[model samples]
Target chain A: MTALAEPIGRGGAERASLARRASGWLVLALVLVSLASLFVGATGLSPFAFLKAMLAGDAVDLRTKVVILDIRLPRLALGLLVGASLAVSGVVMQGLFRNPLADPGLVGVSAGAGLGAIVAIVLGGLLPPALAAAMGYALVPIAAFAGSWLSVIVLYALATRGGQTSVATMLLAGIALAALVGAVSGTLIYMADDAQLRTLTFWSMGSLGGATWGKVAAAAPLMLAGLIAAPFLARGLNALALGEPAARHMGVDVQVLKRVAVVTVAAAVGSAVAVSGGIGFLGIVVPHLLRLSIGPDHRYLLINSALLGAIILTLADMVARVVVAPAELPIGIVMAVIGGPFFLWILMRRRGLMMGL
Target chain B: MLTAETLTVRLGAHEILQAVDFTAHAGEVTAIVGPNGSGKTTLLRALTGDVAFTGAARIGALDVARAKPWELASRRGVLAQFTGVAFPFTVAEIVRLGQASGTAGAATDLTEQALARVGLAGFAPRRYHDLSGGEQQRVQLARVLAQVWEPLDESGPRWLVLDEPVASLDIAHQIEVMELARAFARAGGGVVAVMHDLNLTAMFADAVALMARGRVVTQGPVTAVFRDSTLSDAYGCKLRVNVAPPSSTFILPHAALT
Candidate 1:
């Protein structure tokens, strides 16, 4: 036990406290950004006016009430759900692959879901009239979910041999799968008429403009379920960082972890993409930023990523609303414009550190 | 104690390990030494359940193949030869992963103590990827130490299975790591390490198992296995065992005349 004497005196207490403080800060940012998003739309509803109306209580006008409650609230809710879902799924996928660059979009889940949505839109005529009419608006999201799960299952199978999963193989296979799916989606778009083509294009660009209480209700449960189940994965993912053999030696069920991570990413990203279309970068950006800031302890990174993901996406949605004003820019474009440069910066900084690509 | 009987491993068309019968007892350091591709690593992997194998390998009474990972984890810790972590985890965080299947209690203190034991007390917050190769290897050693901190558990003795634990270390650090393994064995734990340094192996190992061409050529007390002829035949080279001052053993490979 004498060997256990403290050799160096530096405190290990700082990281936990730093993580706690960062979590508090992220939550505060989420709240502030959500409030700003509620008032920053093209409707000319100023934050001051909104605050005054809130303070007045029951004195607010019908137009203000409708804009705040019926429109902005649902959009904010959907944005929060999609943001949290995408970011947490990113953490899971990255940890599972043991690579910072691994993302749901890069791994073909978003593309698969996009293809599924396109199929529903373009090929809906092929379904029985009664069934198509009955499914109606719900068909695309359901199809998208199924497609995402299918792609991930295939990707997981292809990338894994025996009990080991190769991150490089997963990434390369994902790119190939995405290209294959994209080509098929393109063919579907070619067969579509102008209106269907417009829908497909708009969905691919990714917008929160179509947010409604119905969409919010549909996507919320799945996202919440995934988020709630995510923290339980922290310990397993942490062990996995040591490589699979060591992780298994440390008592982590590596197979179970892989299955759970794949399912969680598929469910969460699948639902988000179903509702919000192809919102890119939120997954990769938020987790990488949080890891850089707080270190890669998944116990802290996952929770903080969820909060910061919500805040950043909400703020980005706000920018999409006001930057052009009246006519909305797709939130996906806003995120890419912001996240692309940030990703490049990360790569440049870690060029020497990134081994095995 | 760890025991393997008639263990055979085949990867596709080639046999990696053949009928490898070995045993490492509690309170002893067992060193497995062989030439490159001599199946020393493969044998270690088979013993730790890292690779599928035929025949029997057991940690205490639990079968290596059938035992649950968590069940095995509480009894033994393993240090692999190459641990390539992909993220920028701190030293403390990497070590804390060892506690994943440990009994829930005060782990932070244990983590710090483990680091301190490896001469890395204040390194908790240092980025693991940022550390030098030798430092990173020690951090991994600290992690394994933390997993089975108590050499003797309620269920008899624990074990440390390491694959070339000092391969990346300097001479000073190599001795330090070897001393750590010796200390673990002295404290009633079992140590099974794949070693290449014959001098260090002779200095620390109570028992030596020599493998050549996927088979155990000789295994027993150091005196019996360190004979020059046995070493020469196992390594397929003319080797001289030099008895240094104070009975330390060193193996020297003879070079051909120019």
Candidate 2:
């Protein structure tokens, strides 16, 4: 009773409020970017014209309607889902690893997922005919999830000791895993037929170009499961920042939390990579920016990262479509160009405070 | 009551703690004191379930090994020797993590209240990483304090299990921390602290458990355990305990050894 005084002017409350406020701004950005994406494709449908035609009850042309509804809508949906998944996965990974640099891409989860997708694509025929038929379109995403899940388990085992994660060990192991995965993927690529080769080439340069309702349906639930599951792990992840033993002391079920977090990351990253290929940097970039703006509380960080991630990736997708006109650049290229330099800047700024990496 | 009977901790092939029997009653401050590498920390960790140990440790009737983490956490708050925040969390935010709802639901303003108790009033906005070592340690203490703000809850008396709580504090702050622990004990809670400073231990502890080489060398009331022979033999040095000052005991390493 002696220490219990009047609690006043709490900063945590203010930070939480700021994070909540930012979500509104990010939602607005997402809407604006989504609208722009709908109208700014290579086919060039003017938004004003489309709205006017629809308002006037004029029968929109089949081609125009198809472009707007079928192509742009699914692409936008897939973009939002993949973007949110990547960003949320990044938050979870950083929280689990207790380091901001611990991104899915940086830690080779993306590469592992990529390997899974390549394996599924190149070896689909080798599967028992009945099993392959039953798996259908879900095969690639499932394979990718398994691959990412496996990689996370292996990485966690290697880099973590007595509940402390070694950033240096994680990064080096990531590079090593990526190299091994690349070699495996290369062997698979070499064996691919010409048709599979085209699919492989296009998929490697991450793009939302092949977005179909079927593809969206296939990947959405997996990513949605991950996105939904992440917020539940937010408090646990927050406690984990204080180290495993302390987190456990704080009533966090550290083992269960870690298991959920690993699965959530795999589910999100694996499916996102399956559909969008290796879309680099959205995971690290979005979460880092949100942390800088809103502070590192996962309660806010997870949701805000989802919103901002969707906004950024959608915006990136628009730029990818607009910059080259009919022949679009891969969104992956755009992200790497932006995120690579940004990552280097972060590394330089934080060189002094790697927290004993 | 918190009790650990025949507690043994083995890390790989090394036995960090061997057959350590310990007990601390509610409304008392029990200090575990010993020289370096005396297994003081390991014993505390075993009691707190931070380490895997072969022992029967109990908080009241709840067994340490079988009890869920939340079950134990609700009864006691632990302050580890070192806590590193991975991200740039504010002081208030870190402390808020100790609120009951830190695991879920909405949390009250206990964050600021705890900070004030640790002599860190109005430090809620400062980044945790920017604080000095002593300040950071106090911040962690504030967090642990917030976790079990009420010494005696409806269930029973809560506990403060601290490992070198004042290791990084200044002399004045050291007294402040000891006084805080004493206040908690006075308010019907038990406090178990792993201490290195024998003088502070003598001044504040109600009971003492002097340990050496993973075993309890002596355990009893402060007067009985703070004898010159017992202190000197356990610490492996000539330690002189002055009983001249009756209000608070003092232990000094003998200046001239025989």
Q: Rate the local accuracy (lDDT) of all candidates.
A: 0.85, 0.84
Candidate 1 is graded, for docking, as: medium
Model 2, runs deviating above 4 Å? A1-10, A106-108, A120-146, A149-176, A189-199, A340-357, B101-107, B256-258
Candidate 1 Cα lDDT to native: 0.85
Which residue pairs of candidate 1 clash? none
lDDT of 1 by residue, A120-148 (tens): 99998899999999988888888888789
TM-score of chain B alone in model 2: 0.95
In candidate 2, what are the lDDT values of residues A1-357, reduced to their tens digit? 111121222367777887777887778778888999899879988899899999999999999999989999999999999999999999998998898878877556788888888888889879999999999867876787678767877876787786655656877888898898889999999999998888667677788887899889888998999999989998898899999889889988887887678778877888898788878788777887677667789999999999988988888898898888888899989888776887678667655654433
Candidate 1 Cα RMSD (Å): 4.7
Provide backbone clash counts, one per model. Answer: 0, 0
Q: DockQ (Cα-based) per candidate?
A: 0.50, 0.57
In lDDT terms, which candidate is top?
A: 1
Candidate 2's displacement at residue A23, Å, is 0.4
TM-score of each: 0.92, 0.90
